[model samples]
Target: MPETIWWKTGTVYQVYPRSFQDTNGDGVGDLPGITARLEHLAWLGVDAVWISPFYRSPMADFGYDVADYRAVDPLFGTLEDFDALIAEAHRRKLKVILDFVPNHSSIAHPWFVESRASRENPKRDWYLWRDPAPDGGPPNNWLSNFGGPAWTRDEASGQYYYHAFLAEQPDLNWRNPEVRAAMHDVLRFWLERGVDGFRVDVIWHLIKDEGFRDNPQNPDFAPHQPGINRFSQVYSCDRPEVIEVISGMRAVLREFGERVLIGEIYLPVERLVTYYGPDLEAADLPFNFQLLETPWQADAVAALVAEYEAALPEGGWPNWVLGNHDRPRIAARVGDAQARVAAMLLLTLRGTPTLYYGDEIGLGHVPIPPDRVQDPWERNEPGHGRDPVRTPMQWDDSRHAGFSAVEPWLPQTEDAERRNVDAMRDDSRSILTLYRRLLSLRRDHPALSVGGWRSVPLPPSLATEVFAYERFEGDETLRILLNFGSAERSIPLEDDAAKQETWSVLLSTRPGRAGEATGNVLHLSPDEGVVLRAHPSS
Candidate 1:
């Protein structure tokens, strides 16, 4: 890897706009607030910021269901505010990537409104619409990702429309060229506005099965929610035609120099890699979500790393995301103590690492009272809601967790005082400090940022509890060792001759240590990890 490779040398920080900062005292984060915080992010040492959707929407699915793709949402400030934010980010040498919602649009959108007005409307074919069964039931057994039936009936037209999500989010008919052109126009809108790139939402679901056939039944479905065990949805998403559309999107991105396009795909490694396209004319980065699905084990993680590396496309850029607005924080998923180890693994890996908001401070999931839950998915499915992860970011120990002057849209965590940026900024041992150090180290070292990765097989005695790998660039080699278990472990380096020389520890989770190394054999405490670079002079 070379430093010139854009994806290899940058750290991306994801910001969930609504919970980031609120300057208007209206209890919602806006673009102006983000502009005000550009200096803080620049000081923290990130190369780019991926802001979640803030486009004009109906709030049915927050900003995911866009009603107007070209304008900023009123709740998130004006178009001028967005321009200021982008300008400020560029001034701080940070790239700004806006979220692009292309799979569906709010029903209130003018296109959908016209499409659903009547069967004779010119835009009727823009969205998926079909006749109902003779018995007045849905056309097929498709199910929404959120819950319930995927199709909603329209009384005026005597038909039903397909929606893989909420009914208010009508799925766009990608089979229509007009719809594709319209989406491309939306892309041009942001590109012309000087946005560095886009984080495409549900990119895989842009096209559906052309035949509109019924999906297979999911035999392993649980009874926790309605339609959980109903259909497999194999044909409803990730259609082959998606690749062609993505190629077109990549073509548009090429017109702008050094612009990036990342896709949100939840498929397996094999399917996910296809989003890179056959000729590398697709998403610049298809999110590697192995951390989201993999079991937290030494062997499991090691195997997953090897598998993902092997599966990547030729010349394809790699990226990793441990936490996001849609998923629980890595700290809560693997316990607070293991969070540091997770961060080390993320930063040391061979890809651009994306850190979710508040993850640096070890923010846990906020308990959303049943009545206070605002997430539509969680509200519809009480037990399986993602509200816990989507809570307001804890900035300080204020009444509203310093997120808003009034009550936040979502409830703040009770322990926000102890787990906020203000408190952790001065605490040397806090997770925030560890993140800052690790990010700084990654930025300072070309070996850590753009080096080739090779898994260092530990001795059988150490393999069960320890996961280690070597990242090399020319003659320089950096070894990263992590103990996934809760006990002391010592691992012998397989290449004893290579390790005979003294090594300088670059970074570690253990406190009060900087560049300390002993010999070929190294000792690690429970959940402790270190990054060591072999010293050539010694």
Candidate 2:
């Protein structure tokens, strides 16, 4: 591994601001609160902090439905507060990346307000709008992610507006040259504000089918409609024109040296790679969500890792995310023990790893009572709720889990005392300790950051329960072994294996067992994992 900037050497901590920490008695996390906790993040050894939307929004989809891209939402803090946060984060040697939602804007946005004011308004073409059908219905048969129709008839203009998400978040008409320029200005505004980079929201959705054709019905329709299933998105998103738009964004970031542009693309490996563009001029790293979407099988996980590595464009960086504000926490996905195993995989993988804020403490989802749910998606679709993962972060066992001095806007987990950061920080065997060790190892070892990865094939019997891979740089090589099943497993090693003699255990799920290696036969308990460095046998 060679010396590189903070992005290549350290982990990224993603903070869902509204739920991270509340400084005022407002019961919502704000920039000042984040500024105060920079030391805690610094102690965890992360090089960057990816703050989810704090931009002015209608709160229809939290901050995703942006009302103003350049201003911080009053609910979160003021522009001055955001500036303070950026200064504080940089002082602590942490880069700040904001969540840039470019695909859509809140219907209440001034641009949209004027756009809907009249069909002939200069801004009218800034959003996707179509004339109603012969029956006075939506233009086409498209569905929003939140269920129901993706189009809403605007009685004001006798036309229908397209919305890929919530009705209030009308999809931006990226086809319009003016719309593109305006969105780029939004990027320039933040870059000038000393922000490090952006985690682009729904980068692939920046373009849509020009014809507004009805999406082909899914071949396999389950209880969920084809429109809700991924198949429908083939025509609706990841369009070829999106690559050019991404390139324009890349050009914006290149103007600012080393500024990152990460895309949130949920397509297959083949299509997802295109987000990097034909000549690698698109997004720097299209967020690899394989871990979040893949099953917990060892063989399956191993295959996906290998495929993703091979698919990355030349000079394009790779990034992985285990949990996010929008999805279920990894702990709930794989159970407690496996969550630790997944952590080892995330940190040791040959790329930048992003850790969701509460994940380090092994935080589980809080069961949100119906009345307490705030997500419009859940409110619109009663049974399919996203409230569990969006619960307030638990900091201490105090009232409201220390996330707020008053009752939290979102429900706090019931077991906050047992799972809060304070309790875990002091426990040697705690998940928090494991996270610290893993991140520190990456920070200290150059090999872990820029090494070449090679899949170490395990025997069929061992492969079913254990996923193993090796990353090497020059004479140094590190082997990562993870047991994904509920059983102990071992694999035979070559007699003169790389790093056979001096190879030491770098990290392990079991407490106090890191930095020690025994022999050729590596043993891992159920849902256990280890990172080992090979020492050459002299």
Candidate 3:
């Protein structure tokens, strides 16, 4: 039998470069700083690390606005530094995935700069541009993700350029043959440098409606939702033509054997599966962000997972994420105790799992003061900034949480002193210990790694407050149970005959929970989660 790909069976850890570590004393994390901390990840047992964009940029939208896809940004150190980081990570048996932003580039990029110079410029077709509507406003009703109109008028060219995100990041015209070719070359550049894969950013927006048609309004949009939610994004993104563009990127990855491509697509489960392409030619994983965005209720999360599993096409694989740099931390979303349960769920689920940095230590969103805010989105839309979750890593109780010698670019969480890698390492009851335990169990047991997932029935009374699922591989089966409520509950085990058999506790969220039992009912404390191996023999 052929061995499964690392990305398929391994967990990926995401590191936000600016906040991971700082070895330069400049209050900013660089590639070398990441290199210095590779041991921590190896100790934590993550299978891979996906670093966000670190390419040359003008700091418009952090590194998301790419000025030079081919060069390493000075803030992140030289190309040599990135090379060293990759070498060190591989030496520790970890695969490295880089963030690829094909939807747009920094406005200062030469292609965009030349395109704006004149309508006749040779590079004009490299980016999306359109003449203003009769009203002399934007070309369409498309809105920028940061807020306001998506099109910024280019006065010199008597036209407007479209930007799905910040005006500083102009959308690339993937419809153009030259634009597609250039982006493919960018993939080759990284592959040649030995990147295991890419996490393509805003991949759904690669090809928009050719007619520049207006996007329809989302009827379900609530007033409290983000401004962009007002539009259904029908014409602005997820066009049918995107499949071809994704296939092209996939072809580049195919040239390098054993590599992977992950898409950052946020769409309904049905539409999201299309990115897999016929026969799985698109992304290896169209990142499943449900665990991050779904409601925290047991029933809702279970339904989302079941729905997503049913929607996946043949040859398509699923992935899970609890949190990322763009959203609030998992601990912040579900409270500290439940975060441990989330970790257990992420690792045991039947797919590749992506772990955001700092999540293992139960890090939550930190409050950012108005005076020190650095996120552009927060500046554009006051309460919507991502700065809180992008704060420096809490490494120790030392000054600045040991992330930097001087002040960090962003503030650390208020509990930084107590909730850090150093503090959690020796404490068996800590969230970090729970994460390491879960990861180790996943690696040691096939039932927890590549097993098939099936829901285990519980009593109707416990269904809403408790989640129970069984992972089966070969003859071994592992069951995981999580309690979301604040009181103790006895979860009924449906199999009366199996009650005659013994079950051994593999691990539990609560510290010091280890034993074997033979019973029809399992007692679970509030916010408790446990994994048990069933011995079916009489």
Best by lDDT: 3
In Å, residue 271's CA in model 3 sits off its true spot by: 1.2
TM-score of each: 0.97, 0.96, 0.98
Better of 1 and 2 by lDDT: 1
Q: List the residue pairs that clash in candidate 1.
A: none
CA displacement after TM-score superposition, residue 460 of candidate 2 (Å): 1.1
- Best candidate per TM-score, number? 3
Q: How many clashes in each structure?
A: 0, 4, 0
Residue by residue across 41-66, what tens digits does model 1's lDDT show? 88778899999999899899988999
TM-score-better candidate, 1 vs 3: 3
lDDT of 2 by residue, 309-369 (tens): 8988777677889999878899999989989998999988888999998899988767887
| lDDT assessment of candidate 3 | 0.89
**Candidate 3's residue-wise lDDT over 371-407, tens digit each?**
9999888888778899989989999999999999999
Clashing residue pairs in candidate 3, if any? none
Question: Listing every candidate in turn, what is its Cα RMSD in Å to the true structure after a full C-alpha superposition?
Answer: 1.6, 1.9, 1.3
